[model samples]
Target: MATKFKPFDVVIARYLLKPNEVFHLSKPLMYGAKINTGFGSINHDDIIGKPLRSIVFGDKDKKHKYIVTRARLPEYVINVKREAQPIYPVDASLIVQAADINVSYPTLKSVDDTEIYKEIDIFRRRGYKLAKNKRNDIKNDSSSINKKEEIIQEKLLILHGPINSYNGKTITRCSTPPLQFLECGTGHGSLTLQICKSIHASNCYFDGINDLSRGSIIHSLDRNLKHMKIGISTVSGFQKGIYLDDVEFHYEPIGPSNWVNSDIANYYRQLCDTTEFLQGCFLDMPSPEHEFTELSKYLTVDGFIIVFTPSISQIWDCYTFVKDNDLKLTLVSTFELLTGGNGGMREWDVRRVMIRNSEMVGKVVKPRIGVRIVGGGFIGIFRKIP
Candidate 1:
């Protein structure tokens, strides 16, 4: 019979030599008869002692040429610059034991591009409906959505106010300043704008990214920042914005690639950079394997990352990626809060997706729907250490 599908912690225990550190065995180590461990044992002695290179010859071809074929790459030569300290606290005796092995949040089909457009139209109509009633103080006359404060309130409604005053308080508790930070999948720039506003309030400069379109993140950022009484310096593109601060944040595009010229790439070069965060939504989806590697590069020694995704599979993938790469888990939250308003469609889209994917019952509509999602959304957070 096949081995049982063990829990993540158990599976992790087998591969890790220390907390948050995985034992990516050298060819020599893999052949050891008994893999030593604090909890249990493993045996693969048959392959021990022989240099891994000797295997290709078998019994007959001892004289075969050891040609370094380009197709068959040689084992990597990883040079350790110096002895490194433990990235995370490792108590060999303790392990991550939990009743639940994994939690999955499913992706929903309710809010595709057409649905998104429909919702946007509905949201815009709601604003006009509210403005016609002269319901609240019309603050900030910048552009079309000049009454931004009212728009913010309305947009929150669209999100069903899941991110109400209480949710904001909860998220704000752990939302500390980092040397650098990132907000990914920034759609209409709502969360990006909020984060930017908060960072500005702290007099800190952070970097964020959203895919550009005819009227997308850039448009949203432009509209929303205009509402702020403070002077918010907005720039164009990831490469240009790196100088925003010594520390910054990165939000990935819809796809991932090995080519490393993103906002996070530049931030990695800074000496003082310590903390980083990774956020995702519909606009931020990338192949899971690729995203994890992209995220790992930006992390610092004892750095932390916060990831937001709509699917439980994505969350687990992110968690495993972080763990296998020697990252730590600081906090996790499924509950997201948002006050509906204009200039934040991407934020609203995430909420909409989460509501659709999860079984959680959305709060009743308040005042009216400022931010509307056909269903709820999902989010997760993770940390990294060097």
Candidate 2:
């Protein structure tokens, strides 16, 4: 909806190759602010205020022109330099959809700490769904408890609340409710970026919260610092960081059984005790079950546990581990993405294609380990077993 490209905006330039067809240029319209988009070498100065998707000539001869525009969420993920494999737009979409995510437009007036979280004799209370129309809901929200959220006992550490800093680290943040989701992997940030797009409209309406709030407060963790650094920027660089404020990237090895006892979780618990719960928990890291017992402890009664695995055995390992440990969760669904990584093309066949190795031969009865859970792997969805 923006009319012109703003400063520091990462723009996408798509050139028409033939009738009714266009393809993006290899070089992005950023960095030193100069990029040659096949038409002509574009200058940082010439693009500062240009209208998006409009024809811009590469030369004064006006021979090569491109329809320049802002990069959409999907385009940015594919084109960005990745340190690790991305979740692919296909897998990311399935994760978001299966989680039943709902977002509201963020309001400009920040939440007044006095007005929202006055009771820290206590922890933060969860927010309720008031109305879709954010423009009017915040103003007349005083008389509505009919739809108030059931305050659960699970607690979340408020990253913004007044508390002793984490080992003396600064806690410069705005007060808000406990975040809704947690992800253990921050590989290439492809899925993280996609999640940002979904929750963009409904967070950070309050003043001084995340100065760049876009309706999300995701805690994305990766043990690899290189991957974490890329994720932080890959997501922050989009749209001049329109969704940058939504995610909090942390570098931590989050998959041990003792993970709940880690310094980070302990530090959080010391500040705000057990009233915050994550609505959704995602695992894309190696051996997610190692963190399953500890992380799933923070889920609201029926919060979800979603895992993306290249091997079906991973999910099986997760399910058995949770059950064996009695982790209060139940498998809700399991799906195979036929063309999951081959872009977003979904194939539902009559005879129907199946996982790569659906069976084992000669009485060995092994699942042919590493066969993509049947040609496309699997997504395991679970719900907190109340």
Candidate 3:
């Protein structure tokens, strides 16, 4: 099918002359600007409105040939320049899948099986005669039907991509896309952007303010003012260029104890109480267990709680805390591994715990995939339980 490239749409251009290099650009391309490639210069306007994957020869000389395609989530994530390390696609895929971000199946099968049978039965009862040519056309359209199914699957899987930092030591924890979510310790805002995308895809609203009435809002906290500013700026850049606007950043130092009386904490409490409590809470800090008491207050019944720490000692401490507070939370899964290969290595031990809300048991969270350990860190999966 021919697809028209529209203004402001992101496009990925691959130059045939330089097979290894790829260029990402926005549409409504500047007419006069020359994109200098290894072989020759190509005008931006030459590729605009062209069907994706169509080859556009360079400057009529045809010395440098180029092909344009719609930019996918992975391409956008990889091509977007960042000061802080962004989450790699491999790790990001795992996190998104675990959260059940884009898991969906088509309804065509049900329509074909049940609806078609009902139609056939009705037609037979009515003694209706079907056109022979129409029946032949349906048979001939089987290939097109399969193609439509493929398109549906492609649309469902289009948004699968990474969220943020994966240092082998500091893994960002996640849950099934949450309507009300909290991110403690925003580092560089890589994951924040991913979360924003998730919220946006889910059609949730984020106003960057503590508005309890909003559909979805992410409250990102960081102790370091400088780092918080950087994170904010990073997300702002995304908002301006990539259009991510659902994440709110705060420079409040959140500790298990200190945040209970802070203004932000109070704001969070009001936000939670007004709109059913937080659907997910991701804790990326030195000692996440310290803040569990305060964190649990904001969590909704059957909400997800994910904690990431580099130290095994910290994991053990958090485990013990969950054990002691059996009524409030439970230990779900622990992922630990050490591996090295491909000129890279990783050593990580992380734990995932869930709130014990009693209403969540038997509810299916995404199943945990076995860790291959090609990389260093492993993620633990957990769900809130009664």
Which has the higher TM-score value, candidate number 1 or candidate number 3? 3
Give the Cα RMSD of candidate 1: 25.0
Best by TM-score: 2
Candidate 3 per-residue C-alpha lDDT over 52-96 given as tens digits, one digit per residue, 9 for 90 to 100:
787876556776677877766556556655555555444444443
In model 1, the Cα lDDT at residue 265 comes to 34
- TM-score of each candidate structure, all chains considered together: 0.29, 0.68, 0.56
- How many angstroms is residue 374 displaced in model 3 relative to the true structure, after the best TM-score fit? 12
What is the model-wide C-alpha lDDT for candidate 3?
A: 0.50
lDDT for residue 93 in candidate 1, whole number 0-100: 6
| Candidate 1 lDDT over residue span 1-386, tens digit each | 11222111011121222323433221223333343333334333322332332222111323321211111111111111112211111110011110011212212122233432222211122221111112222233435333544554354234222221111111111122222344333332223333332233232221121011101111111122232211112211112222232222222223333312432232222212232322221123443434555655544444434444445456556555555665443333332222232211111221112267778644321222354221122344444444
Model 3 misplaced regions, further than 4 Å: 1-3, 17-43, 56-61, 100-178, 201-213, 223-243, 253-268, 271-276, 309-314, 324-327, 336-376, 381-386
Counting only residues 3 or more apart in sequence or on different chains, how many pairs clash (N, Cα, C under 3 Å) in candidate 1?
Answer: 37
Ranking by TM-score: 2, 3, 1
Scanning candidate 1 in windows of ten residues, the lowest lDDT window is 91-100
Q: Least accurate stretch of 10 residues (summed lDDT) in model 2? A: 148-157
Ranking by lDDT: 2, 3, 1
**Residue 164 lDDT in candidate 2:** 29
